[model samples]
Target: MGCCVSLFSRKPRLEKDHWQHTQNRRSSSAKGASALSGGGGSSGFTEFTLAELKAATNNFSSDNIVSESGEKAPNVVYEGRLQNRRWIAVKKFTKMAWPDPKQFAEEANEVGKLRHKRLANLIGYCCDGDERLLVAEFMPNETLAKHLFHWENQTPEWAMRLRVAFYIAEALDYCSNEGRPLYHDLNAYRVLFDENGDPRLSCFGLMKNSRDGKSYSTNLAYTPPEYLRNGRVTPESVAFSFGTVLLDLLSGKHIPPSHALDMIRGKNILLLMDSHLEGNFLIEEATVVLGLASQCLQYEPRERPKTKDLVSTLAPLQNKPDVPSHVMLGIPKQEETPPTPQHPLSPMGDACSRMDLTAIHQILVMTHYKDDEGTNELSFQEWTQQMRDMLDARKRGDLAFRDKDFKSAIDCYSQFIDVGTMISPTVHARRSLCYLMCDQPDAALRDAMQAQCVYPDWSTAFYMQAVALAKLDMHKDAADMLNEATVLEEKKQRGGKGP
Candidate 1:
């Protein structure tokens, strides 16, 4: 008789899992840090005194607190204007194990050296006795969550949403490359819009993890699977968290990866799209984004895509280009509020139809466009061939545009347009967006007008034209264009032929 295979007779030899190895590496690194004399063992970093920080923050008064959560926790953040009248965010940490002033200074110095365009640059740090604080460049705009999750203003356009995702990925990639392999608590709140309306990742993420026993304020549903399993994070863990942010952009809600993965695999992604994105977002792009998110959310940490890959993949899907971070983040207008859209006509739709000619002319003058050779009318078969060529050219443009290669997109889209076989409104609109991104508002307006001429009743064409008109300060023309587009859209919906 063959030896009976006993159930649970012997346990398999244990192999160190990915998280275990990561933890080991982290432990060794910490030991290495501890061995240094302090400074995180380097120098050249500004060290602010406790008294200086207190004065800057008005003695840590409640009035200066800037954290939206309104929590009086040990880790509190304050908005302070420094001596030179430069605004800075001051973070006061409640006491923990960082007692060695030299060691704390050293760590802060090492982290402070981390600088990237996407990061809110770290200005300095303070570690005076029991008091520990960090100072960073102040971001005028609020957190990404306030814009994407709960905005009082207009929701970010599909293109801007895509851009934000790409920006964060690039920021994470920068951190990993700079030797700070792990970003603690990567989330929407950590991304802020600067004065120029560009998104900047909070450099405060470079600080050591909280020692005061506080954890993430967000729901665990969005946390990486590895973090839940081992109570630790790796670079891959940050990627997993980023995947959740993508989900938020796509669905406008916090959803568990397990459920989201199920929907993705089932080809039911349309059900998960944000309602606000209806008619604006493309199914193909959404699928690609979802695919990336799924890869990032993979169960095996090793299987997750790297930050480099994430950046490369997302660069092409950016629809609208150069949208100010303030606009995308819904930064409150200081004075005049723009006109709100009537029902059935979205704000963007209205804005586009109204036309911003002054803005358009300003943007137009900024870019140089190739002459429009003009398209010739074609027979059905010839049109089909032209369409194929147009699509191929547009495909190249889309990829270039996603990568923020505006010049290339313009060239490719121009080729498609010059061929002039297909009357594809979307292609025209896409090229217009590219033109706008490249600061060629004239080119943008031209494309928008061409789109309208091709598809007389399409709202997008009118909207694009209106944007150009409004930008050019042709308010009357812009308003009229917008009214025409709205009326046309309403007429179309009512099953009429034309306005």
Candidate 2:
């Protein structure tokens, strides 16, 4: 992000809708704060008071620890209140119980930043310095991993399983290039559910930011071979993890402890899926998902599509009206296919066309999204080649792009076209600020022109243009640019009509 007078980095983040507290929510920890300075969020992080967390988790009692379902490892949870005075569950994190410190922080960061309609919110954090604990908004319901694999005693509608799968994919997209959530750890039991039967991701034990700055993906079972071999996790590796989760989602079963061994033997993938699905969903969609999964789970990370592309592939299903689980599995439904597609995104292969666009767009926004500092995955990648290169570079040095070195800075900005475009708008808009501070209107106006040309649709660009032109004493051009921008916005709102 370039230095701008506005202080707001236009990172295209999902705001108030996701992080803004729903009510006067209060946590045992006072987790929801009105404001905190220098922290990442807009007003900084809102922590759940320990009091609210304890109440939400029933005083963090052992009885709340539900027995682990199926062959999955055990999990314990507690319900508590939040700052809003609402109830939420808190998942306790054991000290270095899973991964490394850096790895652990990355996980929490991803969970902290991930915000989806279907995904839960990360309200606060607790770390005794060395030990870390993660607290989410808490969904009354458990996890899909639980209802499907652990609690076979219960019957999850087949339609619901697919819906769960779809929502999870959206979650992945949110955490992936679309939402640019750096946090995504696909360990077996991380995803949670709410009373509304919606799913939220839990367990940031291994998530990492996808931005070039941090640690990446985890999960040895789902990790791509390319990543593991060379220490690089590509979007392909994530696809592989999605495939592994899909198998569980479809089969409605957990990965039997022994199954990991069987996976090594190449047992039929379908056999691993939750037996509950019983081949009930659309074979075409299933095939695509599974096939994509297979590609993702491939020993090679290059074989899979980025999650953004994958979501585009799955968007079409949103159009299909909700059908009974039986109907989904060819059981029967009065209304199956809707008259038209319900989702606004392209249904079919549109994702492939825009994969790069989505990926870059997502990456750009991540720098500005608010998240917990302890869990910031700004620099964790399992084994991506490029990621490794970046990490190696970081270990070797620090931010050499200081503004003092004008030529070096410009060169640095130029090669990073996408990031440059994003920063240029801010730098350009603050042209006057630059001139006032450094007496460098020449440099300021140059950047302003570039920013305006690069992101013209963005209002900041026009305003910056005004500053630059006015500084150059070309007041007419400056005014004309602002007026032109106004017309563009008005025309856009009126569907291309303006006086």
Candidate 3:
């Protein structure tokens, strides 16, 4: 690990000329990452003058060898330096794509500098010509994916997978729901394991702050259906991915799509278990993981659990040796996840928003005393009426935002934000999400930025900038923004997102 860089404290900002020095970056960052990957060298953020990177990364050698040798290799690639030495694995980008590079860079910048037993640190980078790079401490183990796919060596024990699954979920939940844009990608490939077999998320190229990453490297099979269908990417996707990963851990195989569908139907779900586990795991754990996975994969995005909820669910998985062996072959043979228990919709709340299963569930819960299990429990007519009312609310909010109704949008969200005793970060994120929908980047940027500011050191705000930048076609800027966010976030907590 490395020492922390003081971002909030104040440091000389980089000069523009250094970043714009080259039209070509591959020629510069080829040497530095390895030297920057560990501690006792470049502990904090290391900004390299263009010339330094030119000497280190061999000018961005395509053969730079980002991944390690053998079946277990690292997923991210980078070229940077540490403590004035070269040959580090962390990387800095040239002409970063994120909308708010400062935000991400600020965060990731810190990551390179700190050192801790549980937390990894940032080391160094290449600074030249519209590109900024950071060298972060690298973990030795391969990601959870290696075990999940297990092409050669023995697969990770089922209990270990379950333990990892729970821990990873909690980590991601805290990162996302704690009001930061720090969304974990659940890139099985990025969850590294070492000689000691400890699990860690290799976030050099992940856990980015983005407006939307539904299209990013997520496993399609694990992604929430809403994100897959709509351009809008929400936290529900994160929950969905978490649930899927949990199920996969138990099953000892990627859940097959067909089997998943059966689970939804409430069919023979026990058959979904991984035979390799050979009854080594418990039915209770398998049932719970499966149940949660089904909930997360709800056909409607709204019905899924929030990352925070996943965090609550995950706390129980750690240190459980008897954790079950479940595997995802696909949708379960059972019934699809059931509907959400909605509270009655507030008058000021979104209307069509209620049409989203999640919204509907919220409305039902708010309005009704108990869940109506019978078909006649709540007349189809009454449910339709409630839905219509929510739709109207949604329409009104949309109309206002469309009409430049910032106040109305804010008002609508405010109502939801203050709803009941629990104000989910999703609501806040969604409120800001409105700005993007309304074509107001500055506003959205502010809201997103505020999320970071209020929750300083979280990834969500950084993500807002990343997505805003990406939405504006600033891929390089988006990437850079993610970098800053990670750096800042890394400093506050390792394997944890900021609050």
lDDT of candidates 1 onward, in order: 0.64, 0.44, 0.47
Instruction: Compute the lDDT for candidate 1.
Output: 0.64
Model 2, range 1-499, lDDT digits (tens) per residue? 1122111223331133212221122121122112211111110123434444455556677776643444333234566544333444556654445445445444454455433354565645553444445565555556666666556345565556556667667767756643453334464466666544555565343333322322333345455456557765556655666666766765565453235435535845556555565565665665565555555565555666676776676666554455533333332222222111112322111221222323322322342212111122232333355434533332222132222333443433444323311233433333323342344544555454444333434433444444444454433334433443343344344563211
Regions of model 2 farther than 4 Å from truth: 1-44, 48-59, 66-77, 83-85, 95-113, 128-131, 152-154, 178-184, 203-234, 255-279, 318-499
For residues 235-256, could you state the per-residue lDDT of candidate 1 as single tens digits? 8888888888889889887678
Q: What is the total number of backbone clashes in candidate 1?
A: 37
Q: How large an RMSD does model 1 have?
A: 23.5
Best by TM-score: 1
Q: What is the lDDT of residue 424 in candidate 2?
A: 35
* True-structure lDDT of candidate 3: 0.47
RMSD of each: 23.5, 17.2, 20.1
